[model samples]
Target: MIRTLVISISSLFLCLFFTACVRDTDFDQAEDISLSPIMELDLIYFNLQASDFYDTINGTPILTLRDTTEIKFLDDSTLQESLKRADFYFKFTNSIPRSFQVDFEFLSEENNITYETGTAVEQGEVSTPVITEFTHIVEGEAISQLTLANKVVVSVTIPSSNENLQGTLNMKSKTTYFLEY
Candidate 1:
């Protein structure tokens, strides 16, 4: 008798489970989905001493110093397609007594300049450091030119320098990217 009762209940539950209603799912809604992500990355940093701008052997000052850094990720096809906007930030801490000009040149693989920007750093004393900040935003048509760059050249220009020049000039920079797909 117990066995028959157990079998009856099991049959009834199975019948009810199979008869439950579920709403229809529309897979086409997935087509309207999109993703947007923002990313920030460190671009470059450098520290230069006063002596770096002076030529000890030649007994003259080197007015400018340039450094090149590869930015190959900007050339990626995926990044080029999804990147909607980009912003570059540079911060300069100057303890040197001479004002300077800093330039950023974005170049393509063929050494062509795609974009160029710069900032002027104010003169400061060794006892008191001066901070200067600069921002460059690329959107709309400018984004196209930025995507073509595979390298960046940084040039620091000083007005004058001597063996007795004292203090340092430091820089920190970063880039923020906005992407949508």
Candidate 2:
């Protein structure tokens, strides 16, 4: 009888302890949950420069414009294609008075990728790449990168007879990037 009484008391106490810990207070309040989801947008701006015309940029043109290609992190959607700028240019001062056409190419490892500037370029835009002759080079190449989500581009120019041309030309380039978000 003693043992039975002790076990019953302990069990009863345990039951009450657990039960008391689970009491619900009825405050009667409505829930105001927010439905909008939050997302991260990392916009990495890159100050682009024309390091080299032949091998440096020619080999990996897209990598040259690495900053402009990082526009895919604005939303929740995964990046299937990389965004690119098309209004690329170069500025040059020709020693001799001559007329020549300059160009550039943005090559990416990915397939079917293209680059195109959504809007037109203005004159004397600094900090960013302006499609000009010497910005990249005006000797033989015709243009530099100027497009979005593109792969390859080619600028063509002929030799000048007298003085070399000196100015800036806003050209386009091809860039192929993949969205992995």
Candidate 3:
């Protein structure tokens, strides 16, 4: 009889202890919850350069710009939206009067995709050297949906001329990530 009484007392004490340990929570009152959602945004930039036009192959002068560059975007698993925009700037100084055509091609190494952006023509008819600048903006959907790690192949074609032209290329990209919880 004593053993039975002890076991009953112990079982009641355990039930009471477990019941007190579990606190009732009202999920309807969400404001009282300690955890909350958050939102975030970010912007990123990139650049590229080419500086030599003095080399010639097979006695033929070459002035085409071929460069490989790296870039970073958001991961695919991240539940966020992003937009990528880019601006390509080319600056050159001509030593003599001449007319030239510029063409651009961009390739993505991650996806093996190629994009033929644009082409421009400029004429320098002055006797003195002059500095010229050209700009191209990239706003394509294919480029905006890039992976976190990527490479961009830049190809520029400029016909060779008797006049010498020294130039530099720069690319600036902006990535805007919109994250909401």
Top lDDT hit: 1
lDDT of 2 by residue, 25-65 (tens): 54453353323332223211112222221234334322122
lDDT of 1 at 119: 89
| RMSD values, in order shown | 3.4, 13.4, 9.0
Per-residue accuracy of model 3 over 88-181 as CA lDDT, tens digit each: 5556554333444444433344455555544443544345545556655545564443433355555545555322444333333333332332
Arrange candidates by TM-score, descending.
1, 3, 2
- Which window of ten consecutive residues has the lowest lDDT sum in model 3? 42-51
Structural similarity to truth (TM-score) of each candidate: 0.85, 0.23, 0.42
| Two-way TM-score contest, 1 vs 2, winner | 1
User: Judged by TM-score relative to the true structure, which candidate is superior, 1 or 3?
Assistant: 1
Error of 2 at 158 (Å): 2.8
For all candidates in order, the CA lDDT equals 0.93, 0.32, 0.46
Clash counts for the predictions, in order: 0, 51, 0
TM-score of 3: 0.42
